[model samples]
Target: MNIQHFAAFRAVMMTGTVSGAAEILGRSQPAVSRLLDRLEAELGLALFERRKGLITPTPQAHRLLDEVERAYVSLDSLKNLASRLAKGQGNQVSVAVLPALGLSFMPRVIAKFRQDWPETKVSLNVRMSPTVEEWVAGQQVDFGFAEMPVRRSGFETEIFSNAPYVAAVPSGHELADRSCLMPEDLREGPLISWTPFVAARHLLDQVLVTSGVRIEALCETSLSGAAFEMVKQGLGIAIVDPYTAVLQADERIRLIPFRPAIPFNLALLRPEFRGSPPTVDHMLSFARDLRDDVLARVPT
Candidate 1:
């Protein structure tokens, strides 16, 4: 299929009419319409229906649109690559981060990266822990920061920081005044928690096994923040990463380092099959700088 025809078809779909697409693409309406026609002929499917001079999307068009938009995103990424290479800015970075890091670390990294490589174009893709590893190993993304362990086949992983896990407890709880807590501390209480699929849970489970301690997950949830709220409301104590511990606004909960120091280590997952892109490499360095800056001020 013709890429130009696809682009034209996409433009028409986005702009709602041939004339509107012409305006956006700076082409004549007839030219846009012809390209769209060529695309439809090739696909043997009508993309739109002409109703009272207005082009309305067909069932097939709507069905195909989501996939087409993803194609456009990839195409746009490639276009930016070409433009950056041609201009020789010597700097551009694209980094994908997990949902947890998006709250705090990613923003600081982006700011510092821009300062060092002012000409760089930074694109941030915030994803879940599972996706972050896949993106790096698959080479679909340049870099990723996640709260999970690195398990992908073609990626190099390192422990940037051993993010100690903490138990968030209500202010009136016996352990709230303490700086650290053990698994046995909440053996009698309900556990507000994260998914069992997560690394944090894995580590906690390991610790529980050796301690012969298993607290009932009376109220479990997928979101760390939401689980924290459950504890703040005196429902249960949750084992959460330090990142979320600091961001939550509820004054009723205290963040105490978990005993046995179940480490929620952070890593930079990079593609193993290919050398990193120049921009992506720069972003990796930027991320390291961001990590160092954060560590300097945080309590040991």
Candidate 2:
């Protein structure tokens, strides 16, 4: 009922012994037992049963422990946040991104952000799209970047950028001579592609099928950057977002537009309960400027 009562209850339930709880609470064993007894009397429920100097939690105690731990964890987080603010290091932002964006696009944005706000700290996590969506919905990060149209509630989504998928060919490969590629052009070669579960893969499959083009698949990968690497190694021609193609471009690989353009889209997401930090808005503006410039010259 009171802070002391809750603390005693938690300490005793957690440590499973009156002496251990007493040590944790900086009290004598008798004092700890008295606190527990008072709490039980106040609530008119037995929180623990004791026999032979061992303490065992009652059913109600087990049910209450989870809520108690959660409250303490939140309090601990608040304490840490206060400490950070005291040290003048609270200007921090966290973002969750999918592998495709993390590979190169986000690194560029981070660098630009640091250039402008040198004192601000940025944390980035590269995870699957579902995880990114979940983090955004849960307010775990300032925002998240992921594939478009995340259907989860409790988040607002906006278009980040869009570009067409392009073909990646190894230097001196037969397709390198072509300025643009068609599905039929890739039919004779082994295709390096994303895993089947990827949205891009669904689009690619539809295009190939509708064009009556089929090819042997050399490999399927989760990361577009990995597909680009395979292309550089002459594994096969790969279809990837223009951002990745531009990032991985070199004399060893050529990026060309594929016919019937498959759009690569992304979204900026924010939780409904949290307002975007000014820094986040600024970063969003900076990223859009960079995206416009980069996408304009994406080699096709």
Candidate 3:
């Protein structure tokens, strides 16, 4: 039950010999052997077999090793965390973002944040809105940028932008001449769309029903980039957030505002329990400036 005994056993299991384990532990071979003997006695199990100066783990040792390694992994993570704290690198910010913002907007925010706080460590993860919300609730991240209306109750949510959705089409498509499109305009042809049940898709569905316009969806995708690619391939036209349109706007793709404006809103999610880390406020200041710049340039 002693931690030292477990350490000795883990070292022997990893190194395959008492002498090798001794070298790793900075102890004599005989001392490591004694630790192993004590561990085996306490556990009432034969952990290894020694023969011809070679050591081999017994079946019981292999079974115990699974749990041992799992524990050590947690310990190693704690050690790394402590090392970071000791080095004054604990003023870190971790953010989770949905694909659209992560791809288009976050890089600008991160770059500006780094310019002001070069010593701060920043980590960004691109995930689905639900995953981002879960990370915020779990305190696994300092902040999350995701589609708005996150269902969880304990987080502070702030709408970052509420631009209208835009239509993505192949650059030379017939509709490219128009500055904006109505649902009826898109209803005529095959459309690339989000699958039913997606938050944005659900909202769009209600609008379609209300407008008496049914989209002839040829293909559905979860990622904005994928939908944009499908549109570029002439598969179909797609309605997407302005942020994605801004990132993917190119000679191959044309973005036009969608009429009646399905508001493409994104928000920041931060847990109530953790309170905002000071680094989060600093990061958000940079993010707010970037959001304003992006909003001004993207299609209305």
| TM-score versus the correct structure, for each prediction | 0.65, 0.73, 0.72
Candidate 3, 199-221: lDDT as tens digits: 88988788888999876687998
Against the reference, the lDDT scores of all candidates come to 0.74, 0.84, 0.83
Best by TM-score: 2
Q: Sum up the clashes in candidate 3.
A: 0
RMSD of 2: 7.4
By TM-score, highest first, what's the ranking?
2, 3, 1
**Model 1 residue 79 lDDT score:** 82
* lDDT value, residue 70 of candidate 2: 56
What does candidate 1's lDDT look like per residue over 221-264, in tens digits? Answer: 76676777788789988987666666554679877767788776
Off by over 4 Å in 1: 1-73, 83-90, 229-235, 246-252, 273-286, 289-300
Tens digit per residue, CA lDDT, model 2, 87-177: 9888877788998788788889899999888998787889878878877886777888888657687789888877888999887887788
